[model samples]
Target: MTPAPRDRILDATLTCVARVGLGKTTLDDVAREAGLARATLYRYFPGKQPLISALVAREAARLGADLLEATAACRTLEDAVVELVTTAVASLEAHAALQYVLLVEPEVLLPYLAFRRADDFLREASALVAPALEAFLPSDRVARAAEWLVRVVQSYACSPTAEVDLNDPVSVRVLVTEFVLPGLVPSNMLGVTS
Candidate 1:
């Protein structure tokens, strides 16, 4: 089955962005990569910014789907969280366009990741993650816990530390056990009855 024109355009945009940083990518470039005319591209997306915004939204949805799939088979919340963090780290690291942008055009992302705009990113990410956590967290507590998890995962993912390696399962499990789980699940729940 063929991808829809919009998806094809976004995929082509990612390829073009990966080849050349976002700053250098042009609509002509995307059109060429997509094998579509510049006019057709324009018909779908009015302008460059709109195209980029659509691409970002598509990627976020993809990430959300991937996270849900990764956590689906986990029998415990701890396992789910470990899978979530690990999958997020791997996904971000493996995204060619995103890695290229981060390496060469970080300023493009700064507006969304920093300052007041960051709250929007946090809110969106929290919403994406909150549903997955619903099984483990009370309905009232899920949003805050998801936001905190996003903040922690984002911090470690964006500016990694020597003390904790997000790629290492054991290290991630330890971080979850020591920090994440304790915050999400109360001591009363985590404590052994015996």
Candidate 2:
């Protein structure tokens, strides 16, 4: 299927961001890349910030869906959390535009990393994980656990520590099971809950 105009614009924006970095990419660049006039681009995205925001939201949704699919077979809460974190980190690391923005133009992302946008990411991530968590935790606890998982995943993405091997699935799974699961799941239930 042909992509919508908005999607084309976002794709162009990401391409431009990857090439020039978000700090330098402009509406003109995105419009040219999308094969649209500046006015047409404006119709889809009024300004650069809104366009970037849309791109971020779209990418995050895609990643969240991928996480859900990747963990669909998980039989336990720990397994799900480990899969979620590992998948999220891997996805973020593989996103070229996102990596460019984070590594070379972090300031472009700083404003969106604040309370409102951060909460948006957290809410989406929480929603994605909530269903898996429902079998083992209360609704409120599930939400909190999801939020914690999102925070930890984001932390690793933004500033990975040398101690952990993010590339190794077994290493990530062990780390989450040992350090993260205990905090999110009550000790008594952790051993048996799925």
Residue 72 displacement in candidate 1 (angstroms)? 0.5
| Model 2 Cα shift for residue 124 (angstroms) | 6.2
Model 1 per-residue lDDT tens digits across residues 78-101:
888898889888998999999999
Query: What is the alpha-carbon lDDT of model 1 when measured against the actual structure?
Result: 0.89
Model 2 TM-score, all chains together: 0.85
Error in Å for residue 63 of model 2: 1.5
Candidate 1: residue 66 lDDT (0-100): 91
| Candidate 1 off by > 4 Å | 191-194
Q: Write the per-residue lDDT of candidate 2 for residues 24-98, one digit (tens) a residue.
A: 898999999999999999988899889988997798678767877877888888777777777777887888898
lDDT, residue 95, candidate 2: 88
lDDT of each: 0.89, 0.80
* TM-scores of all candidate predictions against the true structure: 0.94, 0.85
